[model samples]
Target: MTAQTTPKPTESELEILQILWDKGSCTVREVHEVLEKNKDSGYTTTLKLMQIMHEKGLVARDTSSKTHIYRALVNQEKTQQHLVNKMIDNVFNGSAARLVMQALGNHTASKEEIDSIKKYLDELSNQ
Candidate 1:
């Protein structure tokens, strides 16, 4: 079969993906438990979401034993980059500089964060 490329996940699906990214492979119950810590969600709701994610090619399931284990199919960095690009285009009119400016201006960055950003810029300048 040809490899399938899943579309960008929905907000709730992203939430589940975050958990899978952080925790690695998980069962439906395992995913449900972690989400429960943050939001009051039903286990079945989480299960259904994950099932749909499987159909969407966003997650892979292993049915080796009894409980099927699910893992995120997309790389976290790639997905984040894709989403950021979409946001920059849609919200900032394709200007990454504007996106950076809005982020820096609206959010308080620590001295360390500012220093890190400056260092990154310096490295980019040398190249």
Candidate 2:
């Protein structure tokens, strides 16, 4: 197997990360409550997941206090950019134009959105 340059969390792990990122820090119960909005997740499941995440270095657990608060160690924006770049490299074969063309063809973007994208492209070209 290739060396893992990026940490790829499972969907469940990503869900937990999203909660910690949004709430700053939360106990397993708190995270489970927030996660319950979407699906039926167990309290223990959340606790176990967070524990595993801490071991993986994806999250930091504060055990000094009464309540074990979990916080994300990785910045969400940086992780998102890394994932996007990896996807672009693998799926789009490093052709941004291919991705853009596919996106434009797949979705019905508003005229304003199209204009905004065009404006950005124009600015980049100018630079």
Candidate 3:
């Protein structure tokens, strides 16, 4: 058993991942139905995408039954952290503060969200 490096999912792959994460394990057909509502794509395309994701170790496939069920193997938090780290390095020059500032400045965070962020910051300061 080897540790798998997280690969940045393509736009299509991310869509499928979002489905798997939200819906849990699903057959490719089940995924395709949800996908069709958002964008035009063939069932074969969805199947192929899941196949590639399996190969990349981003998703796990249960092949016991006639209809294979696919589930996300990559943790959503880990992937978000990985992407955030990449963005911080590339877009903000490794400054998480800059990213936070930009995010807060661009979006009007609710009072609850601001308070939550402040609480987190206070805890970090204590640490």
Show model 3 residue runs off by greater than 4 Å.
1-4
lDDT of 1 by residue, 1-127 (tens): 2223547799999999999999999999999999999999998899999999999889999999899999999889988988999999999999999999999999999999999999999999999
Worst 10 residues of 3 by lDDT: 1-10
* Top-TM-score structure, candidate number: 1
> How would you encode candidate 2's per-residue C-alpha lDDT over 8-43 as one tens digit per residue?
778899998998888898888899999999999889
Per-model TM-score, in order, reads 0.90, 0.79, 0.87
Estimate every model's Cα lDDT from 0 to 1: 0.92, 0.87, 0.91
Q: Which should have the higher TM-score, number 1 or number 3?
A: 1
For model 2, the stretches where C-alpha displacement exceeds 4 angstroms are: 1-6, 104-116
Q: What TM-score does model 2 achieve against the real structure? A: 0.79
- In model 2, which residue pairs have backbone atoms overlapping below 3 Å? none
- Looking at model 1, report the run of 10 residues with the lowest lDDT sum: 1-10
- For model 1, state the Cα shift of residue 32 in Å: 1.4
For candidate 3, the lDDT comes to: 0.91
The order of the candidates by lDDT, greatest first, is 1, 3, 2
Q: Write the per-residue lDDT of candidate 3 for residues 1-127, one digit (tens) a residue.
A: 2325567798799899999999999999999999999899999999999999999888999999999999998888877787798899999999999999999999999999999999999999999
Q: Which candidate is the best by lDDT?
A: 1
